[model samples]
Target: MIDEHRQDLAAEYALDALDPESARAFEAMLANDAELKALADDLRETAAALALDAPAHLPPPELRERILSRIRAEAEAGAPAAPTATAVAPSTEAPVPSGGGRNLLPWALAAGFAITTAALWMERGSLQQDRTALLQEARELRNRDFLAKVKIATLSAQVDAYSKATAVIVWDAEKQHGVVKLNNVPPAGAGKDYQLWVIDPKYPAPVNGGLVPVNAEGIARVSFSPDQPISKADKFAISLEPAGGVPKATGPIVLLGGN
Candidate 1:
């Protein structure tokens, strides 16, 4: 457990408010004491997080005009007033710098202006980062929205051999990918496996869309990527081909569905 004194030192150190002598002493101790170092690190992280929580405030809209007006007033006031009607004896004391008040006021005002400008620049940079993050998020959302609007086509048995079988193709045209869901599908013949195909007008022949593997329950949901890019999926079909499948469909069409 850390003592309150140590915790206080850590907090001051984290805020960078510790005197140089004390800070050096604390750092030396921190290097030797793991527990104290951990406490200091935690304080630093908390301080950084608190900084982010600070609300952003811009300088008042009228601040610039007010400063300019003050400068003009100071300049006018610095001018020697019309000579007094009655003259006085010259002072024996050494003269003060001419327009000392006027000079100090401008320097003060310039420092203030510089601080405000720096703050404004920092705020602008933070806003730009936020805008960039929002744009990236919007782009991701659009891509997801486009992907969600997939084309769903239902595949039915093409012949009495698979009259009881049913499948559905959920195709994403944008990604050129799709998944085939089957129900009540029977096992393929010995030495033969089921294959998937995508019929696209862009291709001379049907594009192979991988193979399908049905479980013992006669149901399955398999994902496939077509061998060639498909702009439009005109039709989805399942065929019986040799085991391990073929490059191009070379077997009887068992199930078929059209756009």
Candidate 2:
């Protein structure tokens, strides 16, 4: 048996009054459960009371005869006909009139027309809601695409920075080798030539790679390996040094890289 909560939900579904998500869930339940379908059918019969009585204005005489003939034909064929206009009785209430002194027939027709127009208006509102949801989804997709492009641009900039810095020095981690690829470094005459220092921020002191001439350009690769692993270095720098390389750097840093 369907649970009490589910039966109530089925009743609401039969009335066509459930919210969208809840309606979809109930429809799925009805599709799979025969018992739920029967319960929904019963509730539908009950709610048909809203449509029980036709309006006071009768349909034209010929239209009424044609309707009755179709009903009689269905009865003779021994097939159960779907419910027809006969299921509803005519309303006896006198029609209310508008201020223009016209017969109530015109006003009743106008009111019925207005009701149909209102139903169409409600349908249009649902269509607009669907359109709004689609627009929001499109905006989200555009934002995602823009963010992806931004990420690509940022990565490209980082790659360009790495390339520019690599042009200044050629360091090979696998061979523990360092090479000076540039010549004529700045600040040449200040009692110091460019000296490479492989420093690890995790270590106490910088390891001397070698002293390099300011104008020399033929790959001044160093023989020294870094004291700590290269991965642990928070900073790397070239310092100005005297003719012979210093055991410890006492000069100003010329270039540096770090977080």
C-alpha TM-score for every candidate: 0.44, 0.30
Give a tens-digit lDDT track for model 2, residues 112-205: 5765565556456655776688667644653454222211000001222222222123234434544433322343465657676766665678
The models' CA-based lDDT, in order, is 0.72, 0.50
Clashing pairs in 1: none
Evaluated against the true structure, the overall lDDT of model 2 is 0.50
Clashes of each: 0, 0
Alpha-carbon deviation at 11 in model 2, angstroms? 68
Model 1 residue runs over 4 Å out of place are 1-149
Please give the TM-score that candidate 1 achieves against the real structure: 0.44
Write candidate 1's Cα lDDT for 1-259 as tens digits: 4555776677567656677899999999999988678657655554343334325545557655565566556666875676566876899999777675659789868866865675566556655766788667654563456334455555667878677675656666765666677777888868988899999998989999998988887776776789888888889999999999999889999998754
